[model samples]
Structures are given as C-alpha cells and as structure tokens.
Target: MMRWLSFLQLCLSLLLILPLPLEAFEPLTMGAIGLGAVGFGTYFKEYTYCKFTECCDDRSIPANIEALRSSLNRYLFGQHIVAQHIIPALSAHFQSRSTSRKPLVISFHGQPGTGKNFVADQIAKALYLKGSESSFVSKYLGQADFPQAGMVDAYKARISREVRNKLHECPRSLFIFDEVDKMPSGVFDTLTSLVDYNAFADGTDNTKAVFIFLSNTAGTHIADHLGNLMKGGKLREDTRLSDYESLLKRAAYNLDGGMKKTTMIESHVIDHYIPFLPLEKSHVLSCLQEEFWRWDRNPDSQKNKKLIDDIIDTSISYDRTHGLFAISGCKTLEKKVAVAVNYS
Candidate 1:
C-alpha cells in the first residue's frame, strides 16, 4: 500500500512538472490566428481593414519601388520610419551572412505616440521583401496572461518554430515582433535568448523566426540628459542655437565646451536639430513599470485584490480617440504561406 501511494505521488509530480507543450496558446477569440491576420485597432480611429499581403498581386505594387520608402508609401501618412536609424540595419542584414552566424537583433522602444508602429511596419516591409517571411499574429492577452508558462515560452516557441520551417522552405526571410513590450517577461527572456545568439539550432528550425521588438520604451529625454552632461542645461535653446551658428569660431576660441556635435539631413535649411543619446533600456522599463502599476490601480481594469494577477492584466490605453485599444488578446500567429520575392 505504501509503495503504491508513493508511485502515484511520483507520477502526479512528474505530470505537473512537465515542460508545457506548444499549441496551448493558440488563439480562439480576440481576432484571427493561424493564417488569418487581424486588424490593428487604429490608434486614432477605425479604418479600412488591412488585407494580408498574400491577397495582393504582383501587378499591384510597382517594381521599381523595391525598397522601404516606396513599399510603405500607400499605408503610411505622416508616420514614417526613421531611415537614418533603420537603413543601416537593413544594409547590415543584407550585406552579412557569408556563412553560419548570429543574426542581427534590434530593440526599438520609445514613449507612447513616438511612432513605434510606423518604424515597425517599415522594418517589416524591409524584411518581407528580402525574400519570404512570417510574423507572429498579436493577440490582446491581459495581465493574468503574463504569469503562465503556457502563455509565454511555448507560445513564442510555436512562432519561432513556424518561422524556422519557413526558412527551410525559403532560405531568405525575416521575422518581426510588433508591440513586444506587452508580452510577459518569460516570453521576452526566451526571445532574447535567441536574439542574443542570433541563431537557432536545426531541430527547432520548424518555427524559428527573425526577432525584432518594436517598443515605445525609448524616449527623447536621454538626448537632453546627455546634452546637459556635456554642457550645463542652463543654456537655453536660443543660446544653443546661437552657439551652433558660431560653432566654428567657438571651436577656435576654446569654447567648443564639450557640447555635442551632430549632423543635419540638409545643410541648406539647417532647420532640424538633433540630440545624441541611445535610449537606455533601464529608463524605458522604469517608465513601463510606472504605467503598469498606474493601470493596475485603476478601478476599471483591476481584477481585484484577490482574483487574478499580472500587472499587464489591468493596463489600459486609449488611441487618438477615446475608444479603448484593449490589450486583451495580443498573441497569435498567422499561418505560413509560400511566396516568391519579386521586388524587381
């Protein structure tokens, strides 16, 4: 009798401790999944549904417009990719890969309304045209979704495997993750693992995908902070402008003062001013935690002091209009399809 009870307990423990199998996070609600992509709730308002590129024919897009700018011309308005920051990444990705090596991993983050989506879309187009590609369909999983292993690692693994399969079928392709900041830390850590290596093994290749995280965590404040460190923040904008006008003379006079030196897009106008600084990850997460906790306290979003958990569980965000762009079901992957890249 004692042996039988011990055996039963051992089996039960093993069952409970087993690594989660993929497909458990498959999308059922919140929108399309498994080949069916869904619409992005318009940040400002509802617009016409975005038809998947599979539906688009070769004749629809111009052949000369093989690059990012032309590809995004139809969909983007004022929202555009910062070509200065992104073009080099693409060139590097394209130029590299002589043999087996780690892939490039780029993390883009900024404050809300800093045009995270626009940059992501440009990067998507760039990667998509390089050959063939796959994307993880986003779902709006809430805060409660964050703690579960079923929701995080396995779900992300499923997508990675899908991308890997596509790569074997089509060696040239890219994978992109939009609004990745919202996913739980478990998934983030797993994705980061692959990203750090920039490569995956052959067995897991079935769903391995190129990883890019588009985020709003990076902010403009870092530039100012760096600027202040170089020259006291006491100098007002107008004074700084005057100093720029006299830059050459200031350099000769020993007044270069360690102020930052930056280049402008057009020398003829010189209307644009640029600040230099990489948006550190720590600042972004700090702001994110604050927002996460703030949303946690809101009465409308809280599941309660007792019932479910995960700070992202109760977070709320509104677009240009007051309508709620709920983050309830944001993890989904569209089915993979075979297509040829004819950027011509």
Candidate 2:
C-alpha cells in the first residue's frame, strides 16, 4: 500500500507540474489530483469554489492596493486617525501574513454621525473586492439581533454558528457588530474565544478573520476627553491613540454595554481602540462638500455657500464658544442640505 501510494504521488506531482491550462482539469480529475496530493479532495473543492463561485470573497489579497487606498482616503472624511493608525496597522497585518495571522480585532468608539459605521463599510468594500454586499462580510446590528434580555443565549449561539459557518466557507471573513453598546455583555465574552488563534475540529480557522465592534457608549466620554485636551492647548489633530485608548477601553468595559466586565479587554485581545472624535464645524463643512460633490452640485457656487452656512447654523450646538460642537454631527446635514437646495 505504501509503495502504491508513493507511485501515485509521483505520477500526480508530474501531472501537476505540466504546463496545462487550469480549465483543462475536469471536476473529477481535480478531485483525483487533490486526493493524490493531500490525502483528500475537499481542499481542491474549496479552491474551485473560491476561483469560480466566490470571486469577490475576501479570502484573497486585493488586486489593486493603490486603488483601495485612494478610495478609502476619499470616502472616509474627517478620519485622519484612520489613515494614520488603522491603515498602517492593516498594512503590517497584510505584510506579515504568515508570522502572526491572528484575528484583527478592532473596536470603534464614538458618537452618532461620526463615521464609525461608514468607515467600517468602506473597509469591507475595499477588502472584499465586492463592495458591502459580499457574502464573506457579515454584519450584525446589536439592536436588531440581540435586543431583549432573555435572548442573550440564543444570540450567542446564532452568532457563533454563523461565524463558524462563514469561516468554514472562507477563512478571511469579516464580522462587524454595529451599535454594540446595546448588545448584552455576555456576547463579548463569547466572541472572545472565537477570535483567538484556535483551529476548530470542523476546519474553521479563526486567525484569518476580522472582528469590528462599533459602540456609542464611549462617545460622550471621548468627546469630553478631546474637549479637555483642546482646552489644555492640545490640538485635536495632535491627539494620538495613546491619549484615549485606555479611556475608551475603560468606558466599554465598565459601562453598561457589550463589553462590560468582559475579559476581551482584560486579556488584551482587541488590537485597537479607535476613537472617532466628534465632528467639528470644519469637519461638518467637509462633509457638506462631499455631499455636494456626490450629488454633482457645484460646491463653490454662491447659493451652495449660503446653503452650507444655513445647514451649519441649523445644527444644534453645545459649545457656544466655538459653535463647532454639532450635536447631530453630519447626521442631519443631508436633510438640511435638501431643504436648502430645494428652497434656494
């Protein structure tokens, strides 16, 4: 049996070494080749599935890194922190793929209308190569999925199953949990285990997955912290991750939310605690300009300038000194812009 297996391997190796088109191998032939090489044919099936059925899956490296970088830079407005920290972190992660290969766990903490969800969507689009609708990218809303008290266990089971299923299908899956501040605290602990570098019995490898948690619980705290920095003569742009990373983690772990008392933070598993600072007037102005360009409206027109001013005027503010503390951020800017554009 050993001699027969050795002969089969030699023949298969020679066959695979031949300069032949991939399409020339039929399904049965591919299965045979895989069996001879790997002792089973399932690996070949996964390759074919990725090659033909799931062309947009995140399992492969993006074809155009420069294009992705440009799009991310363009779309995620007012997020220079992302370009600074998140982009470099991702670059390192991708570059040293074989050495670490751990799950990229990121937590986005910020106020509403700050671009946490927007940036998350953009990242998924860039990595999956299929926009936001890719099968490998799974998103769960805390309010929608785990709203009630008694549903915590059920939610845990379902998310675990879904995550495992997706990872089994494609190891490079992306999971985003939006509004996680509303989720039950126990859920975080459940996910903590899965995010670790462990291979399941059913062939689900968690190391290649990415987990993102978005929360509003730490928003006010983050805003206050940044505001204090400004008051102390520290420029907002000069605020680094070290300034607010521990604060965000404290808020998430101590506050009444998904991560409260969870070991995920204590164990130091979360790769980054990204703070999405509250958008100021200039940032809001940038957002308005983006909206104008998105709708093909000329931003420099006199009418548009008045419209932008009106939008900024109407957005309620907390800080009377700078009038930059937009309570709603850019959330209401669209409707404000619409009213301005239509009425003008």
Best by lDDT: 2
lDDT of each: 0.36, 0.77
Candidate 1 structure quality by residue, lDDT tens digits, 9-65: 655754764455535444552234322222223311122232334312122121122
TM-scores for all candidates? Answer: 0.38, 0.82
Error of 1 at 331 (Å): 22
Let me know the TM-score candidate 2 reaches against the reference structure. 0.82
Q: Estimate candidate 1's RMSD in Å.
A: 23.8
Provide the global lDDT of candidate 2 against the true structure: 0.77
Residue 235, model 1, lDDT? 26
- Model 2 Cα shift for residue 56 (angstroms): 7.4
